[model samples]
Target: MTSTGNIRPMNDKKYKHSVAVLISDGLGTFEFGIAVEVFGLTRPEFNFPWYKFMVVSTQAKAVNASGGVSIAANYSIEALSVCDTIIIPSWHSYSDKKDALLIQKLREAAERGVRFLSICSGVFLLAQAGLLDGKKATTHWKHLPKFRRAHPQIELDENALYIDQGNVICSAGSAAGIDACLHLVRKDFGSQIANQVARRLVAHPHRDGGQTQFIPNPVAKLERNAISNSIDWALANLSEQITIKEMAMQAHMSDRSFHRRFRDTTGVSPLHWLQQARIAKSKELLETTNYKMEHIAELSGYLTHETFRVAFKKRVGVSPSAYRARFRSD
Candidate 1:
C-alpha cells in the first residue's frame, strides 16, 4: 500500500470498497468535506476494511471550490469505472447542467449497480442522468419547490431527511449526508462497525431517513405562541391518558379554535401531535430500558401495546423492538 498525505490511489483488492466522489468547479466544500471525512480518511488501526477514496474530477483541469479556493482534483472521470460507489456531494445550483459524457458515464455506472449518493442539489445530477426517474428522492428542503417544478415525474418527498431507492440514494443538506453514509456503512458492514464509526465521529449511528426534516418557521411560531405552553404540558404529562380537551383547556381556547390553531401553528392536528409525542416517549424508553411492551405502552400513554406498536410503526418506520435492537447501547 502506497501512502500519500491525504489523497492516494488505493489499488489493493482486499480493501473491498471503491468510492468516487465527484468534483467540479464551485463544489460545496462542507458536503465534499463530509465525503472525505467519512470515506477518505485512513483507519488501519481500527482493523476494519475501509473505503478506497477517489475525488474524480468532472473536468480535466483543477477546480475552484465554493469559496474560490483551488483544489487539486487529480483523478479524472475515468476513475468512476473503478468505483462501486459514486457520490455527488453538492452541485453549485439546480440549474447546473451535466455534459453528455458525464451523463453517459453515470448512466453506465448505474447499470452496473453502483450506488449513487446525492447531497443537496447533487440530486439534480442523478435526476439529469435519469437515475431518479419515477423514484422517491429528496434533497435539501429549501430546494424542494424548485426540484419539484423542475422534475415533477420523480416522487419527491420533502419531509424525508433522505430516501434510499436501493441503487440511487439521495440525502438532504449537510448533516443528513453523514446519516446517509452511516446507513451505507450499516448496510455493507453491520451495526457494530457502523456504531464504531459513529462513535469515532461522535454522531448518531442511525437516524431513520423517514424522520421529518427540521422546518423552523412553524416550530418557531408555535414556540412563541400560547400553544407551546400546552405542548409542554402534554410532554410532561405523557404518562397519563390525555385528549384534545386537555390541550384546548390548557391553551384556554375552545375545542374548535384549538383544533384550528394547533393545526395552523404546528402543521399537524392535535391528535397526530399527541400520537407523535407518545411514540417519541416510547422510543426513548425502548432505547434506554428493558421495559416490556405493556409497561412501555402504559408509560408512554398508550392504552394498549397493540396501539403502541401500530403508532410506533407508522410514525417511526420501525417496530419498537426493532428500533431497540438496532439502537440500544446496552
Candidate 2:
C-alpha cells in the first residue's frame, strides 16, 4: 500500500466502448481531431480497456473536411445507430441542406439512450433532428443567430464552453471540442484516464467550458492584449496570489471593466478560471509524477492539503488520493 493511502488499482474489466464519429461534408478538422485523438488512437502503456473509434459517413463515398481535407470513413450511418457513443463532430455549413435520413439515424440513437456529443455547428444537426429540443445546448457563438432562429425549442447557452446536459452535450466552437471530450472521458472512465489522455496529448487538462466564450475574437485593443499577456503570466505564476485587482492592474484596465471583460473573454470568472487551471496542473502531477500531495497542494496554489482536498473534490467529484489510487498506471 502506498503511504498516501491511495487505493490499489482495481482488477476491473476494460470497457471496449465502440464510439462512432458521425461525419458529413465540411467537418471542422480540429473538431474531428478531438474525436480521433480521444477514442481513435491506442496507447498500450495506459493499459486497461479502451474505445474502438469508428469514423462513419452518411454517404457511400468520400467526405471533405472544412479545409478541403478528405477523410475515408470506415463505416456509414448504419453504424451510427449501433455505437456505444455517437459523436456529431459538426454539421456542415448552415447554408447547406442537412440530410433528413441521416438526422433520423442519430435521432434514433438519442431515443435509445446512446450518448450523443456535438461540436460547434453540429448542434444544429441535432437540433434539426429534434434531439436537442427542450434541452440546453450551445454551438459556435457566430452560429447562435441562425441556430436560435431555426430551433427556438432548444435552450442555447452562449457563455458556456460546453454544456453536458446528461445524455446530450454541446460545445461552443472549434477549440471547445477538447473540453467536451475531456469531460466525456471523466464522466465515463474517471479523472485518471482523462488526465492521462490530456498529458499524452500535451494539452490543457481542464478548462471549464462554462468559462465564457465572449472574449472579443480578433484580439481587440491594446488593453485586451494586455489581458491576454496577463493571462499567460498568471498561468506561469499560478502559485502566486492572483486577485482580480492584481489581474486588472496588470491588464491596465479599470477593475470593473477588467472584471466584465475577463468574463467576456474567458467565459469564467478570474478566480474560477485560475482554479480550474490549477486543478489541471494538480491532476497532471498526481497521475504522471509521484509527487506527494503536500507538494502538489503548494504547486496548485492551495495553502494546505485540506484546502486542496475540498477544492479538488468539489470540482472533480473525487478525492485526490482516491483518484490517484484507482488510475495511476505506475
The per-prediction CA RMSD against the true structure, in angstroms, equals: 5.9, 8.2
- Model 2 residue runs over 4 Å out of place are 1-15, 95-98, 217-267, 274-330
User: In angstroms, what RMSD does candidate 1 have relative to the true structure?
Assistant: 5.9
C-alpha RMSD (angstroms) for model 2:
8.2
Give per-model TM-scores: 0.66, 0.71
On residues 168-252, what C-alpha lDDT tens digit does candidate 1 reach at each position?
8899988899988887876665456676788888987666676667744453454337688889999999999898999899988
Off by over 4 Å in 1: 1-14, 217-330
Please write out the lDDT profile of model 2 over residues 1-330, one tens digit for every residue: 001121112232454677888776788888999889988898786666777677888777678887778887777677765677888888864664768788778778877888889999888877778887778998988999898788777778888989987888899898888889988987766666786788988877767767776565544677568879778888888886677788888888888888777776666677778888888778777877798999999998889999999999988778999878765656
- The lDDT per prediction is 0.80, 0.79
- Any idea what lDDT model 2 has? 0.79
| Number of the top-ranking candidate, with lDDT as the measure | 1
Q: Give Cα distance to truth, residue 253, candidate 2, Å.
A: 10
Q: Among all windows of ten consecutive residues in candidate 1, which has the lowest summed lDDT? A: 1-10
Lowest lDDT block of 10, candidate 2 = 1-10
